[model samples]
Target: MLDRRRVLQTLAGLFLSSFGLGGYAYAWEPAHQGVTRYRLKPARWPEGRRLRLAVITDLHVGGPHMPVARVRQIVEQTNALKPDLTLLVGDFVASRTRRSSDPAPAEWAAELARLQAPAGRFAVLGNHDWWQDERAQKELRGPTQSTVALEAVGIPVLENRAVRLQTGAGPLWIAGLGDQEAFVLRRRPRGLPYGLDDLPATLAMIRDDAPVILMAHEPDIFARVPSRVALTLSGHTHGGQVRLFGWSPIVPSRYGNRYAYGHVRENGRDLVVSAGLGTSKLPIRLGAPPEIVLIELG
Candidate 1:
């Protein structure tokens, strides 16, 4: 016969193990559908010209769990919004360490290529992409291959660079910087090409007359951005991964709570950080569901 304490301990271990498994499964399922709308009020945007922009990020594509079908569905839904411009804010593929080693990013890229917009469709690299060295090679979700794949289907990937888009009235200056996290790694800095030269100086290169919209994968870089930028778009937080009843489980940031999740304003500039469409390491999201944000530039 087993002792009382041993029996209790065995039961407790089973209960805890089951709870962990259940929680993981619950968070892994892709929940929430339909579009989220936001009317942005920018002080510098020209009057009477409203730009429809759709932002999607954290699609850690290339897993049996992620499946290209999901990406196709996301693209179809996004195109239905009829955005003037679509921005892919990075993390296109899951890091090698994260995936189960079956599906690859090429499959996902083909699905992502299906996305389209009238004015343009653009993208930026995520930390995961850098870790996978997709920038150096032309295959499997590398920055070069990922960019090439998108451009093939008409979406351009901006890496620490800027592009000028012409609206009905005039042109708007758009810029994108690579993942800032890659820059901090001293040992393998060259291993990842996710460094920004000088954010302040880069914005200076764009025309001052046009409204500047910038994309940096990590929102933490917002502090370094120059004042001329009208708005900054970012991801990587996944909106705190797991949001409790009234709090986020763990907000992984250097500043801690300064820019944890969602839309925030700093130094009179606007920032829209998506809750994201896909999961990272654990493949789960709680109170915070996957999101697709539609920003009406006003």
Candidate 2:
């Protein structure tokens, strides 16, 4: 039966190819880091003011692929870009329990402190940052350990807060919302809020009509973002952590691949979702390699 033998050979070939690909995704792609750059001129952005932003998110430190040494490399690479502002979108701690080491927050924060940005370095906590803080979760309030560690190293964690900064471009507002899925693990009583994010309050903090840049850990909030905000930066999906040909089968977001990665523009609003560095549940990466996103906005 020649036809039968051919079918068996084809199946064997498919198995071998898949096995090799799996090996590469697990061992090589997870450690290989790259920079993904985007240039945007949002409608509300100042005409003459060009801002270079270095966005680092989902560091997931202490994972096998993201040791302290790798963080140093990231800092050095970002510093080389010499961005006007450095924004940390969060997830400073490791997400997975197995095969992952836990580095003290101070250790990673110290390295992050070395990141150079002329305008200044600002941060916002992610879901993992909240999840990692057992005490904060138990209490249903924060000052998460990641927040303390980052602030200790001079990085201000903006939670439902906005700061007005005078940049070469002009006066701009950087608003950061708390992690939307912060209490995913814990059950709450009825009428008790689950997420710490407060978008309206954060926006209210902005006094003027200056263009606002919102740092939200998850891109799901992009739907509610109004035209007043120039740009919204987020990084939690990690581009589905295994994108294939621009499609992700298991995107963590409710919107699927719509906000999975890159600059997304909708309804005259803009969002940039970084693929992010470090792995989550599983330490494997395929088409979605680890990346540090650089945004040049005007």
Candidate 3:
């Protein structure tokens, strides 16, 4: 006779652990650097202005998944690459549980400042960077505090703004968008130009015919961006965190699977969504190991 009851109990325990401590353990896996090369026609980049943009995002520091030590490793790897520009997309810290051991915001900022690039380093806030609730602001999602800390460390925080830099490639326009999760993350009313970073306002600041590279926390925003922009980068999905058979089962984008991971080109626009280098919420990573994106933009 088969002991069906015993078999079921064993399976249940396995499932529970994978979701609990098992997931957090998997998150400690060493991060990997994923290199992707893109040639953008719309970039109209001057022959000399080809840019190498390295993107590192979703470092949920202090969370059990990515502690301060692991963050140091990520910074060391990034600097070794010697990229032209580095775009940090956001979600610098967020721990959903109270039992987590997190560091002060300044600790994270000091570690991030160690990263170096020739063109410079720029960043935009992620959903986790905002306040947790409408009232208190001292929790994991520290808005003003996070901005001040990062900027003080040399990583200029670009909030709904654009900066034109004279890269070796020529004039380059880089814009940082206000996270679309602005309303959703804070539980505020949704409307245009009020709670979110105004895309129109950000785009309007760029001059005509300049090759533009925009970075947003969420990949879904890539849909609304016009084709004139040469390349758009984002890192909010975490490659679904736990993918099976090479596909993430749960991507956060409003566009669903279309913009889930990797490079997507449509209607004369190019978007590369990095898997990112840390864990969040559940604190586990399976098929989608932590990834640092190195992109050559020419």
Candidate 4:
């Protein structure tokens, strides 16, 4: 009889622990925001020159987890960092259909417009941005609503393009690749690329030999990223949205946790994948908290 009582107690304890963990994951971690910082001196970085970049990505705004007020708070927090460059790495709109509000594009863009950076603020669209655009999906072409909204607020959406920024270090080139999963092509056209991304053409636009920072929404592209790019930034997997002890069980990337989150260096190339600012699918997070990534480079 005593042994039976001990087994019941053990089962009760396990049940309570799981309930508590679930509550924290659902109610607490998803709402709270934090900052993650990385300082790296890439091999190609100009000597004695430093650059601070604030990266905000996977906002998935308009959802219960990320309202306009949260976006405003994010902008305020990013501005406080006083970064040299601010990068909006994409997924501004919410993908979840349930328990989500549809905040107009302008509403969120207005809040993001308040973000300030010394060099400039730049942007790239994510898969969700294109997926949400009905017209773009049907036409298999873009000028997605996400792009129009950002551009309307004076933030340039860099789609497979590169621009030179005059930073304290020197001329730094920022190249943004279009969303690789931009459109759901109905039928593959002969000789036509699957998605909107054009990495080769984008790289061709670079006229000078300045160190380059590439922004691709999905980190899978990092596998093909050449050594020429000093660093690459991405936000998509959301660090599996429930990471624990530096391992995520369900990473969305094709490469699994290899490019899941944080700084990853491979064969002389570097990539930093932000855990991102808002939840996706089901608004729940565990060990991986929402974050604004700050990268210091030299």
Q: Best by lDDT, which number?
A: 2
lDDT of 1 by residue, 77-152 (tens): 9988888888999888764544456355566777777777766778887776666553443222334545566667
Q: Single out the weakest 10-residue window by summed lDDT for candidate 1.
A: 134-143
TM-score of each: 0.82, 0.92, 0.83, 0.91
RMSD of each: 7.0, 6.3, 6.2, 6.8
lDDT of 2 by residue, 117-164 (tens): 889999999998888788888988988999999999999999999999
List candidate 1 stretches off by more than 4 Å. Answer: 1-34, 98-102, 134-145, 183-186, 189-194
All candidates' lDDT scores? 0.70, 0.88, 0.73, 0.86
- lDDT per residue as tens, model 4, 52-166: 9999999998776888999999999999999999999999998753232488899999999999988999999998898788788777888888899999999999999999989
Ranking by lDDT: 2, 4, 3, 1
What 10-residue stretch in candidate 2 is worst by lDDT?
Answer: 1-10
Q: Clashing residue pairs in candidate 2, if any?
A: none
Please give the TM-score that candidate 4 achieves against the real structure.
0.91
CA lDDT, candidate 1, residue 172: 89
lDDT of 2: 0.88
